[model samples]
Target: MSAVTAPQADRAAPARTASDDLDVVPLRHWGRWVAALLVGLVAASFLLSLARNPNLDWTTVGTYLTKDFVIRGVGITLLLTALAMVIGTVGGVLVAVMRLSANPVLSWSAWLFVWFFRGTPLLVQIIFWGFLAALYERIQIGVPFTGWHLVDLDTNAVVTPIVAAVLALGLNEMAYAAEIVRGGILSVEDGQDDAATALGLTRAQTMRTIVLPQAMRVIVPPMGNETITMLKSTALVSVIGGRDLLTAVQSVYAQNFKVIPLLVVAAMWYLALTSVLSLGQYFLERRFGRGRRGSAGPGVISRWFKVSAAEGVAR
Candidate 1:
């Protein structure tokens, strides 16, 4: 009777399989749905407001957006931004190297430059540069205190508004770029330098080949941010009569009294320029981030192709 009862119990309770052991409960995220709905509502309200607004002066904005003077101003702004960034980045790299050098004079000089420029306001620098002729009538290049002169420059003729704008923007940008470079260099492991030294590489070679390449991973993001900031900062040149985008808009508004519309046109152009720059920065960051851990992902081209393939597969 015991044997018969045991056999019956075994038959009633079957052996568990892998599928039977698995738990298949779906997760519920009700809060996510609530948050998404709230965001959608807010976005809809903002769009409705923009659509219904009458004071935006869309017609005037469209008229001046591509005006000849505005286009020229944009070209000047791009040129200034490019030249300043190039000069600033080059000078900053040199200063960063000097700051890290063993020589006392080089280090002290670099520090003083950084201190003076960073401590002072950029607007003041621009104003000072604009009025530089008042401070010095002539710039002579020759032996100090000697009558012999190799070159002489008339201050008023040489330092025009555009030149002054570039000088002020580039010099001020150099101070900030130096700090960013120094921070990036310091972020590299000490062992990397030591390893390069162990391999019999010169200081310049090591820095050029190993240290800077690695430092770029840390440097690119902040530099991208600086580039964007520099774009906006170009507006400051308007104070010096440099005729940037904002200045052109102001000039238009001054004649027509369409202040809001002209301002809106300038803002739209700025947004378009910045959007292009931002996309370029994203691609640049991706390029430098190759082979780094956790940096693996579908790039712009890859994502586009992936979507295309999915569509083809569905068809």
Candidate 2:
């Protein structure tokens, strides 16, 4: 056989300047000044409106802020968010792993879980769980009629508002969390898994040791987003008579008849809570983005001044 000719090697390409490679332009600094003015004006207008409300009960607002009921309600809200997110994150990991599993049964079950939870409204789920006992008067846990002293799932006993709230929030959050986890896992390069396998790691071991740690870099931003969402969604527990932050505000407002003021209190708490979480999310995202390549983060000013001034010219 004739000797095969060697193929010519291709040279590495040069890096392109962003301006040359893409049709993008930075905004003028004057646009930033305009945005600042607009934000200040809106805030000032809102404060002025609050000051003009003659029916506003500052005393009641302050009283409710310090009241045990409101305090306890807020505490419960935080607890529910924490518990639900923890349960949801755990469930999400399982669901995501199952979804990516080779086993058809596991994949199907996980798919069904995500489909059903994501399809239904969270409020409906909360209501269903709250009234689950109404349908099955009592859930028996014993083996048939053997009475081996198993558990009894009485609706009245087991379907308390708090229990129902946790179940609803956890299950609802699981669907979204699953997607977040799946996306994060997929974002990892295939080579990472291959490399782990080459080192004599089983698939599960590779995932636990190699994949998850890398995936977390992508997972944390969305997790923070979900945590914040769950915080607000905890308010829905109020519909089932679970007194969370919003519900406590509602109770106070209903009795005192200072609707807007009481609502303002609730809004304030939500703002404070979400703001703190938002700051935490920013820092967490920054931490996760370290050592990563381009666009890991936009500068704080850029983050604030992202939109074009003309886009909101009429707002």
Candidate 3:
């Protein structure tokens, strides 16, 4: 081997620096701690105020909290929520498919369905359905242009207030759900459809087995939120006396004049139900998010202090 050149030997070893040790001392997020402390103080104060407020009539809240009527109302509310979601999800899938169909007629019909239902307020729809007898005295199932009434039913008798409530909530949910489903489906790349076709899959089969399962990764989050929203929307059925939680509470408050307490009761139940749904959504997302980056992510404190890969790369 050749002897080291004098010029190379003259260059001193690179000077040591703090970074040379690779000791990455993390920064303390003092601002996050300060903000959290302030928020905690505010929340504590607000809760204290609520506890001290005598006008809330906590006695009434306790009295009717688990009353038979209230329990029945809770059952009815859950029923409405479940039924509406079932109708909405099934109808939504069909409507979404129609909206994406090649035929202009099918597409336009789906569009019109979404536009009309989503355009009108839920209250109007509920009231219209509740009072359908005013517009059409009877609901008749007969041959078109043949005047052969196979079945005839009184509108008032057939479409009860609860039925009207379900119809309104379900149809309205269908409109919004359709858009959510369509958006999720569209998030999938066109290549997916081509791949399915190349594999000899029918359109329906492709949608059911391939695109939809993949699309669920996108669909679940918003659909979860919509479900919670639908649960809350059941309160609107009170206007039509659908015997939901709010309607039952309203009846009690109407008699006792403990409006605030009754309202608090309803709010508590709604909160509890929504919290349960949120937990379900969280677990479902975790399931669908397998193998995705940041799916099961850092905690709030760590996330605040964390650095991005792109930032590290840039450095």
Candidate 4:
């Protein structure tokens, strides 16, 4: 057999065949498209109807949206959220640690705290704090069974509406946050603790430096959600006249008899605030999820949108 030279063989390469080319057709989910269209239409119709309804008093909504009372209420709401979240987060970590401690007393104490707070309704707790004076007219601090009262204060003066609101929200949130933190801590592998021990690190040092840092990947998403929930839950403070956003709106509507419009204003502000918090949460989740299993730089929503776009192009 005669040997073929490299260039001669290349010139004799196999011809392109029709079978090699594929005309792919992506499957269309018609039901999804129909459902999405129906939802969009209904939402648009509802919005337009609200816009055209004179009873809604969109003008009143615009009028009081940025009024001084409403603005102050917004500030108060933000303050309550920040303070409550701070208290909850700090107290949560402490409670979680206690719950995990070797001592049964510490663990039982933490459990009882979480159980009581979680078991009761948060609104009831707020009202309880608001009217704590009803339960105890005076708060005395001193040696028990001894007639020595170092500090004595009226309950009403000490636990004002704002104070009551903070106490209620923070303590309630601490219960839930305790569980979240405990779960996160537990998510860290036992081997990690073993490794830390082998490295001659104390338990506290191991947790503070190695374990907690790793557990943040599990902790941050739920904690962010809890923060948002705390923001919304501040509305309940209005019952005690804690001067939250809802309280300001209620005050105006009560005076002017424009309940719906004022409520619309409050709803708008709440939606806006929650949207901002959700955006921050998305970023935080993305940050913490880095290098973790099943974490691909982008988040679920972003990935979903990308996938939908690619599918659209394919179609």
Candidate 5:
């Protein structure tokens, strides 16, 4: 073998530079700017129209916005929403628990309640409750079929329009809430129940202490949505002569004939209320989302900006 050596490989390498390690900024999306511009233009046009259009009667809207009757109506609307939600949530939790129970009777009863309420239109339910007096002249609290009454009350007196509204809203809400709760419960793993059993926790204790806390992560968002829906649905109470916000506005517009302005007033109040509720829902979701990965943070707006910046740098 001849003593032959391959030529030495090139030892020199390209010089390192800070630029090599630096991130390349991504191009901003053109669509986002376009969309923003379009939205701004539309919003500005709408505002300009509202300012210049005499038919809108912004003065009437402002005048009625803080009127005593309007304020009272708003108060009543909020009261109905709050009370109905409370009643619905409490009843729904019970129904949800029953639905998850081993007892067939309890489960079936819960199911029937849900089926009837959920199947029917809420407007019809409200109407039915309003006219419940016609169906039952009196209600008696006593042993069934015993004819011995502990309390006998006139249905007409008991089921006032407001009471009827509350009952209708609450009962109807219960059906929806039950489903939300049930879904949350089912989201929990079976092993968790077993673990709770091993820990010697009773079913009730397990549900309250272990299951519900975890389920709340799933439950809260939908519950908040339901609350907002319920708030809007309160307007339907006007059909039954319930004096809610819509009714208040209707009462005003009926006389002054400033229907558009009064409606604008109601719309503004509804928007304001829903905005507050949306903020509350955001905080609640954030609170419950703690300890979960990618869950804890400020709102999507701030996070979106952060993510966009990071993407820009990385590109």
Candidate 6:
């Protein structure tokens, strides 16, 4: 009887293990319900608002869409964005290099640049640049030791609205871009720089040929984000009569008295532009991310990211 019971107990041990594995604990996802309610409320409110406004005459919207003035506004917006990015990238690289330089002057200059630009309001800066031209009529650029006839800086001629926009946006953007670039540069492993130095490459050559290329792989996505942000930031240029999209919209509504509708039109265009930029960013990120294998494509990666983020909250 003891021998038979021992065998039965061994068999029962396996069954108990299986039972434990199969046990279903009650897991509560309380936040999921809360989130669902919030989402539903927001959706309902949007639908109800649109329904009440029923005046969204697509024909009027379509008619205003192709106007030459509006088209020009979009063009100016793109132009300002592009100009700011160019200036930002060049200036950012310089400041980043300066920050990383061995000389204290360069590093302090870079630090001050970032500190001041990042600290001040961009709108105030633009306005200041626009008005400050009155204080200085002309600037004289000359060699320190001898008059080598370097070009003069004509403040009166150069401080136009366009110049003001560029100066304001470009200077402001450089501060942020400098940090972005510096971070990306630092992200490169120390070994790479040491190897380049070992190979007898000058610091500049190593940076240009090796570090920048690799750093770009990290830099492009955030740079793309900055580009998109700069596009929206160009709207602030209108304060200085820069004539970008938002200003154009303001002018149209101010004159036409179709304030809400015209503003909505402006918003629609901004949304459309941002949507296009977002797609470009997605593709750019995908292009940069391609060497890593077994990774999902850009769109799916973004979707999964969003899903995982939501899951974190749900848990």
lDDT of each: 0.91, 0.88, 0.92, 0.94, 0.94, 0.86
Candidate 5 clashing pairs?
A: 24-315
Which is the winner by lDDT between candidate 2 and candidate 5?
5
Clashes of each: 0, 0, 0, 0, 1, 0
Highest TM-score scorer = 4
List ranges where model 3 is wrong by over 4 Å.
1-30, 297-315
lDDT: worst 10-residue window of model 2:
4-13
Among all windows of 10 consecutive residues in model 1, the one with the lowest summed lDDT is: 1-10
RMSD of 3: 6.7
Report clash pairs, candidate 3.
none
Q: Model 2, stretches more than 4 Å misplaced?
A: 1-39, 144-149, 295-315
Better of 1 and 5 by lDDT: 5
Residue 190 error for model 6, in Å?
A: 1.1
Give the winner by TM-score: 4 or 5.
4
1 or 5, greater by TM-score:
1
Q: Give the runs in model 6 whose Cα sits over 4 Å from its true position.
A: 1-38, 54-60, 139-156, 293-315
lDDT of 1 by residue, 1-315 (tens): 335587788889978899987999989899999999999999999988876778777888888889999999999899989989998899998999899999999999999999999999988999999999999999878988878889899998999989999999999999999999999899999999999999999999998999888999888889898989898899998998898999899887889899988988888888999999999899888888899887748877899999999999999
Ranked candidates, highest TM-score first: 4, 1, 5, 3, 2, 6
Clashes counted in candidate 2 amount to 0
For candidate 3, what is the TM-score? Answer: 0.85
Q: Which ten residues in a row have the lowest lDDT in candidate 5?
A: 3-12
RMSD of 1: 5.4
Candidate 5 error regions (>4 Å): 1-15, 18-25, 143-146, 299-315
